[model samples]
Target: MESTEPQRYRFTGHERVFHNVSAIEALPEVMALFGYQRAFVVCSRSIRRKTTWIDRLHARLGDLIVGITDEVGEHSPLSNVLIAAKQARDARADVIVSVGGGSVMDMCKAMQLCISENAYDRESLLKLQFVVSGDGTEMLTTSQAPAAIRQIAIPTTLATSEWTPVSTPIDDETRLKARFVVPDGSPEAILYDPALLQQTPVRLLWATGIRGLDHAINTACSSSPHPFASLLAEKAVALYIRHLPNLGDTTATDSFTQCQLATWYTGMGQMSVPHGFSHWMVHIIGPYGDIAHSDAACVLMLAQAKWLEGWVTPQHDRLLAAIGQSDTPFHAILHDLLAGLGMPTTLDDLGLTRAQVEAMIKPALEHPLVTRNNVRPIKTAADLRAVLDLAWRA
Candidate 1:
């Protein structure tokens, strides 16, 4: 039963968005709009070493690029972020231009916070994060105001970090990820070029497509669902179902653009609604088990759907309909889609032991975001362990 009461929707708008082949050409105009002169570029070493895109971008930006750092690691670790922040500061950067995957974008966002707030070390950065209370309540902490500098994201994957105001950076000592939520943490602009996306590894692109799918599914089924968000999420689901299968073909540039559009829709949906178990579980799994964020979705989404079996709302039916599988069960349909994409469907497939899965329960139960935003109430560690047990196998 859907609620009939009126609802409100709000989003932090980007200064500009460019989504076509001419996206790279629009960077100068966007920089002018933001009054940004000196740009510091952040990306992964792999992108810089293996691709000529960075060189082309440099030729385009010319003298505007003050510095470039390609040392961003897999999970945006705290140590690497500090180094990037110092590099940006030393360069006297006026803005950040990130041109890689989610990790690079996350590193830039974290660096922005650290540079603005004068949190130069791990202790200071950790002090700025929200913490979970003994009773599983999240206590959010606010920063001073907006940072002086902003970021421009040109994502090469479907992880959709470009559209969110949240940043997750892993701590080196604790080996746990911490969430940083600043009102102005979102990028000022986003460029989604299909040619740039074509440069990404097919396996990586497919994995992140599952990540976007997770965003859409979780948003549609959120406990506090908004009608507008549901509509966007439904469209995102349809787009992915239609385009993701064809994305592996090098000639399918149109498919790449469509998938990018789907990610944008799901990214908005994620911002509009709180996520559930799969997202929360993946955050924990990524750092603890050394799993990629998107790969964790491959292993956990089915089990999370199973946990929500009887608890799911009519939105599940809408999802089934969007995927053209109205008569099929949601979990079965999801499994088949993942299998088709060559994604892992179980923890064993990801090379995780049952004991490691059990170990995650205590931390998952205490995680602020996991405890606060789950559609299904997680009352105890036992409840989390139950879900973990199901997720441990296919």
Candidate 2:
């Protein structure tokens, strides 16, 4: 969108972001500032076991770190969040220090929801999901009462979940994802340290970097794009293209640090930009297919680029220019990137059955963001199927 276009972007409750700083060292001053004493530490299992970060955290905060849970799963199952919430409550934690990637960060957010809403029972929180109408209309039926707790984050991956307040924990009982937005729930501060990145596996790092790349691409092509957001999104694309494919081989700290900065740029204007196409499709497909989000990005973005090859020229051209890949068609460029990263390039590659793909269609079509803001208007089953077909290996 033109800068002249009227727009508004409210930065979430997250107050400050510190880069290349020790998250543990920054914790004491941030905690004292907010009068946060008793702390609940929710971390990924890898961080707790593979590395000494958790041990370091325990040593740094001492008695102030009231509780810790490392039972966090890959997708952040709702049962996991519920159980962790009970633990945090029993320990009387006043703030949550979330240390992990997207799922861990969002798990912390849902824990806050469970504690604040007093809806510890899996059934209670499951019912809190907003209803979506057949025509893609949605009602915001979440509790009016403010969310009980807030978060401070130390990120271990480049998914950029710490930068947003929204959390989606999968409901294990139904195999669906639940969305929650808590009052004062955004991170109070986010500390980004490349040393933390070392704990994340190279494949995981590559995957989440692709997720960050997904964010940047969709933001740039958003239906209601903002000039400032597009600028950052474009910059993120260049950085990701330059650094991502080589991350695993080089394993250099400079490459990791630059990817972190690219991740931040990807989601910095999330509030201002409304993304479409692959972004919304991933939300539905990732949960339903049990595919990791970044994996979904691998399939969907490549397919969507193919589906949009000639349809959205100017936006595609700008993104092509940003990545210095104007000579190649966008989808081919994406295909080569996936090849370079040794990532999957289709839905069939993830073992998703045709039945699962069909089952996802109705909900994907009804999703509010897909309906309202998809780059191209989706008016028929054929329109949605076109992209899905491109994404499937067979």
Instruction: Quantify all predictions' global Cα lDDT against the true fold.
Output: 0.83, 0.80
Q: Which regions of candidate 1 fall more than 4 Å away from where they truly are?
A: 1-6, 131-141
lDDT of 1 by residue, 204-236 (tens): 998998888888888898877788889999999
Worst 10 residues of 2 by lDDT: 132-141
To one decimal, what is the Cα RMSD in angstroms of model 1 from the true structure?
2.2
Clash pairs, candidate 2, are none
Error of 1 at 333 (Å): 1.4
Give a tens-digit lDDT track for model 2, residues 1-394.
Answer: 4457656564677778888887888888889988999999999888898889899889999999999999888679999999999999999999999999999998998888888889899888876665443433222336666767788898888877887767778878777677765555678888888878877888888888888888888878777677788889889988988888667754577887898899788868765666667877888988888799888888888887787677778878998898888888877887888888888898888789888898888888766665566666765677888768988852
Model 1 clash pairs? none
The TM-score, computed over Cα atoms with residue i paired to residue i, of candidate 2 is 0.92
Q: Which stretches of candidate 2 lie over 4 Å from their true place?
A: 1-5, 130-141, 249-251
